[model samples]
Target chain A: MDSIDKKLLNIMQKDFPLSSTPYKDLGEMLGISEEDVINRLGKYKKEGLIRKIGGIFNPRSLGYKSTLVALEVKEGKLEDTASFINRYQEVTHNYQRDHTFNLWFTLIAPSRERIKEIIDSVERLPGVRKCMNLPSVKMFKIGAYFSLDEEGEREEQKSDQ
Target chain B: MISDRDKKIIKHLQEDLPLDSRPFKNIAEKVGMEERELLKRIEEMKEEGMLRRLGAVVHHYQAGFAYNAMGCWRVPQEMIDEAGKKMSCYREVSHVYQRPSHPPHWPYNLFTMIHGHSREDCEGIAESMAEETGISEYTLIYSLREFKKTSMKYF
Candidate 1:
């Protein structure tokens, strides 16, 4: 990506235009045509760099309860346990981390009872030894913005060389 | 509380917006509302805190942040607010939260999701966070593999 792409991403991450002609607004800011902005973002989406360009809702405000869960499955049952957990639509993020409690996942449900139901079922799994339901008591931050300036600098240096 | 019409609008907004110049117009058409009304509803949602922001969600790994670790700090109850605020100030620290800790087996109450270009970079950030917070007891749980990662579907 070029500097323009980097700047475009930065602006989008901070606050995307809420106007009717957002792409045009983005184009005016980037000094590019609306078509160009659309094409670049389209390419990025197709290439898997851009996940989605849409509304990020506050789950809590939407009456959803979310928790981070860690499980210590028996040595060989890691894959099986992950698949089982994935079956629930509530499980959004699941990962294998480097710890005794290797399997970690995030669950968001409409009610506290639903969260407990899912956890209870997972605990009943044969290889699952332990489960920890860590719900956020206080959330300080949640924005995941990555500045691409350094990469842009590297790109510029490469072209100069 | 969101109205039934607001839910209909949200169902569309939760997914990807059309890539065209008149994206919201297209959405408004699909939702059987005028573009102005759709935008007004979205604005209201933002004002009410139901919607955080309308923006691009990038794949960090593809965006050059190859390493990410969940830095778990066992902060004292009295110091949690201070420590959490301090950790949240770092650009590399994307998420900072205070959670209940399960003792004996698990004893970390504060969690910060740190991302970097490398594993060492992540560790260094955590180390500096530890230094700044004066809370040295911490663990950086690096994700070995991503089994699943997707946005929540709320209607």
Candidate 2:
């Protein structure tokens, strides 16, 4: 990631223009041709450096409820238990942390009732000793970005209101 | 209540945007809308707060940020705001949320996700945060494995 790439990221993070030629819009600001901007971004995508370049919807506004759950699974069965939970499409992010509650996952569903149903089923999964539902009481920040500037400080994106 | 047209537009836009000068041209065609109309609708959605910023989400591992530290702290209810503000002011800290804390088994109420290039860097940030916030009871839980990470499809 060089300066030009960082500059492109900064622009993309702010607000991608809705236009027939969005890359051209980005190129104009950087004093480069549209083809160059597209080529750089395409390279980034191919290298797996850029995951997705699109709109991030607000889950709550879209009528979805989410919660974070931690699971204490048997030592030997962690992988299997994780795989079992991963089968649920509602579970978006699942990770293993070094703690008694080794398994951490976030589940989003259309309603609180549906989320409850998922938790109910997840609790019954084999090797799961205990399940703690830790729903977000407050969300302080939402958007996450890494700044590629020389100062090593990340750009401060506006927090979710 | 998202319209069918809106859903179709979102499904296409959420994926990797076409790397073309006229990328939205194809999306507009696929969504059965004029290019200008599609652009106008997306702008309207942003104004309506239905969408956040349109951005690039880099794979952190490829970007040299392999350390993903989740700092879970057992801050008192009243201190949540203070702790959150203090920790989140740091650029390395990404997400900060107030979650329910079950006693004994789970005493961490405030959770913050910190990204770094190495374990030491993340731990150092967590340490500094704990020291600054005066929340001594905290653990920086690093993600050992990521089994499933994907966005929801409301359609």
Candidate 3:
């Protein structure tokens, strides 16, 4: 990503403008045309650099309970266990990690009681030896944002300028 | 806490905004409101803390932050706030949270997602965090595969 692109990513991710012509506002800040900003964002989306451009709601404010869960599964049941855990809509993120208690995922539900119920059901699944539900009591940072200033990255095919 | 109009705007915002120069114009048309009123409503939602922001969600993998690891720390109960506050200051550390850890099986109370351009970079930050916090009991679990990732569509 170029310097300008970095600046765009930085501002766009943190706080985008709320206006009738939002891209025009972004263009004004970046010293570009409205069409240019839109086109660049479109290209970034196509390249998977920009995942999505939209509103991010506060789940806690919307009455949702979320927690990070870790599971120690038998070696042979890794795939089966992970897939079984994935079937639940509440399970948003699931991953295999390099640890003894390998399988981990994040579960979000409408209520804390539902989260506990889901965890209880997960504990009953065969090959699941243990379940650790780490619910967030305090939040320091909400999401990930990479600074654009960093240079010298492996050149992937560039998105349209 | 949201009205029907708020719900309608959310449904539009959750999906991709219309790919046009004046995206709000299309949203206004779909939501049955004036373009100017649509903009004002969005501003109000943000002020009311319903909508966080209108922006691009970068895929770290595609954005050169290829290496990412979760640092679950086992800080003492009393030191939880201090460690969490300190770790949150680090730029690499994202999404720091205080969670209850069941001992004898899991002993991590504070968790942070750390990202880097490389695995070594991630590990280095994790080590520095451990040293800074003075809590050696922790695990840096790097994500091996992304089974699913998406924003919640509550609207």
Candidate 4:
């Protein structure tokens, strides 16, 4: 990607315009035409670089409860157990980490009871040995903005030399 | 308290917003409201902390942050808050949380997720974080595979 593309990604990750004509707003900030901004974003989306441009809501504020769950599934039943857990809409992120308690996932549900119900069902599933529900006592930070300008800056410096 | 109309707005806003010059206008039309009113409500939600952010959610690996490790620290109860704040200052640390730790098996209370270009880079960030916080007892758990990762479908 070009430097302009890197800059656009960086800006959109944190401060996407919240206006009637957001593309135009972004275009002005990036010194590109509105059409160009739209095209580039569209291209990035198609290329799987940009997942989505939307609102990230606070689940707790919306009367929801979320928790991180770690489970130790028997080696033979890992695939089945993961698929069973993934069937719930409440389960958003599920990963197999390098630990005895390998299957780790996050769930956001409408109520604590719902969270319990899902966990209970998973524990009953064959090959599931142990489960731990780790809910956040305090959240210090939660932002996932990756700066894409470092490489772009290096390229600029190289060209200047 | 959120009104029914606000729920309708939230439902649409949570989806992938259109890449148009007037994207909100399109959403407003669908929700039977003017563009200006929709913008106002969105701004209010943001101020109220109901909406965390409205921006691009990139694929991290695709964005060049191909490696990430969850650094779990065994912080003393008294120093958790101070250490959490210090850890949050790192740009590489996207999330820092204090969670319940099960004894004998899992004894780490503070969790900071570090993302980097490679495994070594992630470890380096964790090391610096350990040095800064003065908490040496920690473990960096790397994800071996991502089974599923998606945003919550809130209505």
Highest DockQ: give the candidate number: 2
How would you encode candidate 4's per-residue C-alpha lDDT over A1-161 as one tens digit per residue?
A: 98889989888877888889999999999899999999999999999999999999999999889999999989989889899999999999999999888999999999999999999999899889898889999998887676666564211010000
Tens-digit lDDT string for candidate 1 (B54-147) = 8898887787677889999999999999999998888778788899999998889999888776789889989999999999999999889899
Candidate ranking (lDDT, best to worst) = 4, 1, 2, 3
Ranking according to TM-score, highest score first: 4, 1, 2, 3
In model 1, the clashing pairs are none
Per-residue lDDT for A55-153 in model 3, tens only? 887777667778888899988988888888888888878888888778888888888898998899889989999888777788766665556764744
- Show where candidate 2 strays beyond 4 Å: A150-161
- For model 3, residues B1-155, the per-residue Cα lDDT tens digits are 66788789888987877657788889889999999999888888778777766778788787777888888888888898889888877877767888888987777888888877788988898899989989898888887767667777774
Q: Sum up the clashes in candidate 2.
A: 0
Clashes of each: 0, 0, 0, 0
Candidate number that wins on lDDT, 2 or 4:
4
Segments of candidate 3 deviating more than 4 angstroms: A150-161
Q: Report how far residue A139 has shifted in candidate 4, in Å.
A: 0.7
Interface RMSD of each: 5.3, 1.9, 5.0, 5.0
TM-score of chain A, cand. 3? 0.85
Q: Model 2 misses residue B110 by how many Å?
A: 0.6
